[model samples]
Target: MDTMKRLGGDAFAPQTTYLNSASTGLIPAAGVAAMHEGVQATAAGRPLDHFRDVEAARAAFARLAGVPARQVATGASVAVYAGLIAASLPDGAEVLLSEDDFSSLVNPFHSRPGLKVRTVALEDLADSVRPGTDLVAFSQVQSADGRIAAVDAVREAARAHGARTLVDASQSAGWLPLPQADFLVAVGFKWLMGPRGITYLVVPEDLGGLTPLLAGWVAGEQPWDSCYGPVAELAHSARRFDISPSLYSYAGAVAGFELLDHLGIAAVRAHDAALADRFRAGLAELGHTPVHAPGSAIVSVPGLGARQPQLSAAGIEVSDRAGNLRASFHLYNSSDDVDRLLHSLT
Candidate 1:
């Protein structure tokens, strides 16, 4: 199926050429139906229907990550999993993070009583790892500049020092190849095109005896049976870290996962890259030189921050942050979107 033709691509309709998948994705028609079904089920007192969708969504994300279903857990948001990760680390351990990375990872460790937070340049992480560092955390892709981090190298360096790693994959998951890390968290709202409030937390099975940070009924060896027991043993899998998403959100994520599964993650990635390349080339031809970081699907138009309103006035949608007019690409975007953006600039 032509990706654009699939999922009722014309759903965007008479106006609004969406080019902001980095900020939020346009949910597909099937996804909307799934969400509606979930909502109706909940309304009819069948809220438990969410677990099946949640399980299916977890499996889909597992396939995307090239991991097993046992390593995937549903969460409410990135911050929730970040906090759990922070709490699981050994007390007084030092954590290294990039200076410009998102704060969700940092704020969690900052609140931990004895943990030490260290800042280093994103490019220097691989060189900065040391024996005493217990954890290293950073984004798989930088949200601001859309730079794909040297995360695998960072992971290797951390492992060489016997330290674990956490990768916030919020910007790269669903549409990009996932990095190998000790932990990863991705929100479903962006590239996955699911409803907001659904997040997937990935932790390998070999991570043993992690002290549960946000232990709940579902985080037990047996949720329904272990209720109110004396801090029951955490489940042997990553599901132990789950902060289960609501029924509606779970249904939406499942729908999004199904769409990605149907289209193939690699195909979506190639499409996004092609569109991003076109955007950069077109802007450059129009005298708008783009700042690019290798392997990222974001086109950075410098000095676009001030002209964002004008671009929007001309019916273009993108994020303007600081000095950058950041336009992200996905399967839904087309050549016309880039052309319109260039024409608006001219």
Candidate 2:
């Protein structure tokens, strides 16, 4: 409950002026330490202990996401997680998605044989739902514009048409409340403040029978059994999507979630919103217009190319997409960071 101790503020504070949690979160010292311990344990012939850490990490993430422990699965990357979602559907199933969704969410559908990808604008999503749609995948926050989607509405529309919902929470998982969906996937390196190579997917218990196409030994029903037979039956839980044990990265995620839980997601949300507001206000004052007038942690201001060189010269890190500059803020960011970014613009 002690927020400071639990969140590992000391470890994060000494790092770079890290405002880009949406890109890759700043890892806390605890996470680094945990990863080190996990690696050392693996080296000392105690690999089984690392598996314990992996399961513990999964349980911790499930608690933060308000799901049962078995409902959470870890993947090597967001793309892998999305692949699992795409594979759950029947071949050539029609997948409805947003035009503005992250490429990671769309590429899997393209790779699947017989899968048809349908794209729609964010605002027109409600009207686009049709009865034959098989899967609806979209991001809770648009990566380019940082516009928060009407996720609840989308979920309702998808359900009305008998479609399963797959939410890409890469940008909003730590900053906003996620709406209930049939499937949810997020990368730990983003808002969760964990290392890369770990992503999470949550699948509702009712749709648990969806076969995982990328089956692995670790995902087998009897993971501990050394006798290799036919690929063991895919697990009924979300763990079926996880192919192998990532004990080290999983330990880091556990440390990251511990910090997030200590801070309380409510506080994290408020902090990100306030910081984003400050950044938006500063950009407006500097004669820059944002793509989304009211933005979230990831704000995109137009005319980034004109301002990029100057900001880069000043050591201000920002992402330039097309003609917009993406400024992403996180829990560790303060009003000063916004001020510094604005000053670089001038």
TM-score per candidate, in order?
Answer: 0.91, 0.91
Question: Where does model 1 exceed 4 Å of error?
Answer: 1-15, 44-48, 226-233
Cα lDDT over the full model 1 = 0.79
Q: Which residue pairs clash in candidate 2?
A: 92-114
Candidate 2 lDDT tens digits, 171-233 = 887767766888888887888888888778888876455667766777776777623866657
Please identify model 2 stretches exceeding 4 Å from their true place: 1-8, 41-48, 293-295, 305-310
Worst 10 residues of 1 by lDDT: 3-12
lDDT of 1 by residue, 206-286 (tens): 754465667687777687765785646777788787774576777777767776777777788877887788777777687
Backbone clashes (count) for model 2: 1
- Which pairs clash inside model 1? none
